[model samples]
Target: MSEEKDLFQIKSCGGRKEADEIKKLLEQNDISAEVKEREKDFVVLVPNSEDIVNEALVIITSQEVYDEFYAGE
Candidate 1:
């Protein structure tokens, strides 16, 4: 198994669709994202390099906030 340091988790999701939603969001925004399956949860990952992790996290957080605020719409 690759060490956690190799890839940083942007979000931990309950299911494959949940993980894929944000993964697609990141790719649509031109940021690379990866999905890793854990025993209990799925996680979205980005390279550990500082070059993109911050931006990825920002997008991830922003998308999540947007979804939360507008979910009922």
Candidate 2:
């Protein structure tokens, strides 16, 4: 099988829980996101959405965005 390509990344986060929150947010918004869980850290990716992803690049790495993710939780 060919390796998959990701369109976005969670460049910075305080912890895995935070990253997971972001992942959920992306999904709730109907945006596909992925999480790579590591021993010490995690990474998140925005795969794609039926609607074009806008402001994603601007908000993906912001704590404020992550806050919204948790607020939804």
Best by TM-score: 1
Taking the tens digit of each residue's C-alpha lDDT, what string does model 2 give over 1-73? 1233535453456687878887787677666667777667787766544233454554554657777899998
Q: Residue-wise lDDT of candidate 1 within 7-49, one digit each (tens)?
A: 8888899999999998999899887788999999999998788
TM-score of candidate 2 to 2 decimals: 0.55
lDDT of 2 at 66: 78
Off by over 4 Å in 2: 1-4, 38-40, 48-54, 58-73
Model 1 alpha-carbon drift over 4 Å, by segment: 1-5
Worst 10 residues of 2 by lDDT: 1-10
Give the lowest summed-lDDT range of ten residues in model 1.
1-10
Candidate 2's displacement at residue 57, Å, is: 3.0
Residue pair clashes in candidate 1: none
Candidate 2, residue 70: Cα displacement in angstroms equals 13
